[model samples]
Target: MFLTQTVPRQREIIEVLFRNGWGYMRKLLTGGKPEDPQLPTPAVLKKIFIDLGPVYIKLGQLLSTRPDILSSAYIEELSTLQDEVPPVDWSEVEVLIRKQLKRPLEETCKYLNPVPVA
Candidate 1:
């Protein structure tokens, strides 16, 4: 399905996989099977997720919770995958919130904090 769709980040994702030495993933994406399938090291897998950006970082975080699927080493490594993005200014966030709300911000809440805690 991904191969059929025109995903904007497809090329970047593939490049990151290749750069991280994830040959198994590259083969899977290109509809090929490796003679000897090999997974990347836990650290390398974490690096791949980090290089792929926020979405992949979140996926890795989710995967970290599944002990049945991933080994302790992988879970340990993925658990540390955090999105290191800079916080958006409150002004920009307020504008987006205002656009989403049916009424004014003042009407919706008595006192809404502009600063982001998380």
Candidate 2:
């Protein structure tokens, strides 16, 4: 387990930016467009993540580990935030795994059971 520090000041800054940016964009998109039916929920979440910037997203993710800080409702909603971030390509994953494990991917997992029930 790892212990991490919280920079509440940074979090507050990011929250302010995210809230303001989100409000501005939301209003622009939704204003006078009552028939637009709104953007998809996942789209809204991803947009919020983008507007909030990286620090808030990281903080939210970290906060999910601490139930004592945020209420369960907020945590649940924060957990739903998709960071609008693309994953490393599969080729990159292979390269990183090989580099970290100092072995070919096949060699590292060759003898491992396909399914290990915990």
Candidate 3:
């Protein structure tokens, strides 16, 4: 009785492993190789999300917020990725600020605070 249940579980695990291995082999055979020859690791899906630009990043962040919709592991990984993006340069920010304020940096505020207080 117990053997019947265990056998199906074992077979399921084996099938999953086989499919994954075969898929990886297919990628290798098709020249879907990594750029780094010495450290040829599979392309990380998280890195893909990061590379896809702000839209995907925002989707991941929103998915992280929806715990009910996402799996626990997915939520955790996406949460970790929430703000892992590269910051825009200060120069760009300064330019935007000047444009919005319609004034030079010196005229914006008498006592300009570079960093905002919490």
Q: What lDDT does each candidate get?
A: 0.81, 0.54, 0.59
Against the hidden true structure, what lDDT does model 3 obtain?
0.59
lDDT tens digits, residue span 24-86, model 1: 987887889666777789999888877776677789989989999989999888887754434
Instruction: Name the runs in model 3 displaced over 4 angstroms.
Output: 1-60, 111-118
Candidate 2 has which clashing residue pairs, if any?
none
Question: Which candidate achieves the best TM-score against the true structure?
Answer: 1
lDDT of 2 at 108: 63
- Rank all candidate structures by their lDDT, best first, as comma-separated numbers: 1, 3, 2
Best by lDDT: 1
Candidate 1: global Cα-lDDT?
Answer: 0.81
Give lDDT tens digits, candidate 2, residues 24-90.
4455545543443333343345445545556656765676566797667656666655343434345
- Could you tally the backbone clashes for each prediction? 0, 0, 0
lDDT of 2: 0.54
Where in model 2 is the C-alpha error above 4 Å?
1-49, 82-118
lDDT of each residue in 1-118, candidate 3, tens digit only: 8998799766654454344444454455467873432311222434445554456677777877888986676777777666566554567678888999998988767765555332
Superposition TM-score, candidate 1 onto the true structure: 0.59
